[model samples]
Target: MPVNYTEDAFNGLIIDTNTIPTDSVEFGASLTNILAYSAENNKGITWLTLPIEKSHHVGRATALGFIYHCCQAHELTLVHKNQPAQFVPFIPSHTVGAGALIKNSAGEILVVQEYGMTGYKLPGGHVEQGERIEDAVLREVLEETGIKCEFVSVLGFSNKHPYKFGKSNLYFICELRPLHNHIQILDTQEILDARWISLADFQRDAKNSAYNHELFSALFNLSGLQPQALENNKGAHKKLEIFFANHKDGLL
Candidate 1:
């Protein structure tokens, strides 16, 4: 009886081809000859068969080579296929999040420590469906910190690590001013603690926590703090520079 190849079987055969040594010319020639013979015998394959496979492999190799070259040229750490990239789209999940940087009269920045999360982050939360990002930020801030805020300017954006929460993108850096008189913080399930700290204090806590270093750095740069302060704080400034640099390339 003739060998029968199902779709899955054919796919497995193709995968098996990957293990073939690239340096073996005889192996390549033998595989090519066998594929040609199989196509001729099967009569199901057409003129496009060999060309299509060749094209696909060539294109894939070319793409991979280009990526490798770019990473080498830029001195970037190359991620393998199995090692997922940061901020990549995961399974479909609805996640609309936003954050704000609020400065008080005493030059303190507003930050909140969530009950479950490890780090102290800025006040923000998921943007509900049919809600604008600005509105979401406003609502989240009020709900978390018990302070109404007026939107000022946009700082930047960031994305969550891939393979987590369906690869959500978190919109960070919307400047805001307080509006309410009584700073009566409402203790909610989402937030455990809230407080305004000096920029230095915020930086210290952020460094200690597993917070997004790049995002915080971008926030500091956008704040336009004193040059002396920024220079004195090398870690903060370095993080900011890296964030801004990544942000620029992402835009392009």
Candidate 2:
């Protein structure tokens, strides 16, 4: 079953330490209140959206470190809203990734075996800084598997649930038009293998599949995608119109 989570799921405790004026006493007090609230309320997670002042003189980093330490001590879940991508120096952190659903001429889906991952997964990876979502999808695909592809419409997104993903990861789900027939694993150190796999084969080996089976199941069913129709790549080259439905229809 999909984890039914939403923003409202939490008794949102927005800990904004930025409002504290440039006073040492005030800063210390704010920090104390944050830790106390979290320690007292063993439930709600803390969403930190503090100011970005890393200067040693300003002591913003030190304040941020205290927030971090408090969460660690209380075993409280933390959401670094100020630093969604961690592209900046240091505020808190969140990762953004892009992935593609690439189907081949045989209609088989493309999957890659990662060095640390089990079974197989869609050919995609972390989006580089300043990279567009579509570009990131194509770039990651080519980097992992030397297979060029054309951009198709996106198939919504799978927001990484903190419980499953550990941190907040907004992953884009894109439909890609493959240009090459052969897949060449370029990054041998990071990638184990890349190849086409049939839906039947994927389903049959679900027992031995990766830990992301629930995610794939949610992807296909939520997107209203038909695996049975595109199971075989026996026809001429044609553009596939991917069907999409909001995966967060009910969960979000």
Candidate 3:
């Protein structure tokens, strides 16, 4: 029997895994029927999502030409093109990270030395799923170094290809204002040391990357991008944060 399915906006069919049989032989037969039915009905593509419990059926689906698409903690998604002319949607291909560039009135920058890594670098980490960029930076900074800060502007961003797990990485350079001067180590495991270093000392250090040097050198003239409030704060755009070019204030 053909498996239960639903047509998505792109006319692709999303198979209902709950409706599939537990037995591999039965699933193979049902999937074959579904593919035939989809082709006959001119469907665009077929999405097969199998839970961890139905892992046995993965081989059966692959034998019928389903390619690996993406997966989650407890499930896997496979896709097969039914319509030769239709295009498959691109999966998320980049991980977002944020680095905080916090400067105090003493002209010292807050830097941290991560475990297994040499030299001091800006404290940051990967942005969690459904997390705001500003919030992620603030959280990482506070977690790595016990310091409260307010978001300033996005100084710049760097992109590195073939990063962790073969996904591209987007590292945003965020300028922040320190709320307090006290420095305490919070994430003792990941961070080795957290302290304030003068701008002159940071620039003289050979351990710092050229990108970091340029950012600091051009700091006085760069205004960076600042997040602006949206006029239409409803529906899909409500939670979205838009960064606009900063004109009035400079970083220095």
Each model's total of backbone clashes: 0, 2, 0
- Model 2 RMSD, rounded to 1 decimal: 14.5
Off by over 4 Å in 2: 1-93, 161-167, 207-211, 214-252
Query: Highest lDDT: which candidate?
Result: 3
Model 1 agreement with the true structure over 1-252: per-residue lDDT tens digits:
121222221111222333433343443444455345544544221111122223334333323321221112212221112122312222234455778888887777778887656667788866666566667788888888989988655676666755232255565567788875345567565577788777676666644364544455557646421111134546633432122222344431
TM match of model 3 to true structure: 0.61
By TM-score, rank the candidates, best first: 3, 2, 1
RMSD of each: 17.2, 14.5, 13.8
lDDT of each: 0.52, 0.59, 0.83
Screening candidate 1 with a backbone cut-off below 3 angstroms (N, C-alpha, C), the clashing residue pairs are none
The local distance difference test score of model 1 is 0.52
lDDT: the better of candidates 1 and 2: 2
Over all chains combined, what TM-score does candidate 1 have? 0.47
Residue range 40-126, candidate 3, lDDT tens digits: 988878999899999888899999989888888898989988755555644568888999888899888899987766677888887
Q: Please give, for residues 63-156, the per-residue lDDT of candidate 2 as tens digits.
A: 5542342233223333422323332212234567778887777878888887665578888877665566777888889989999998765666
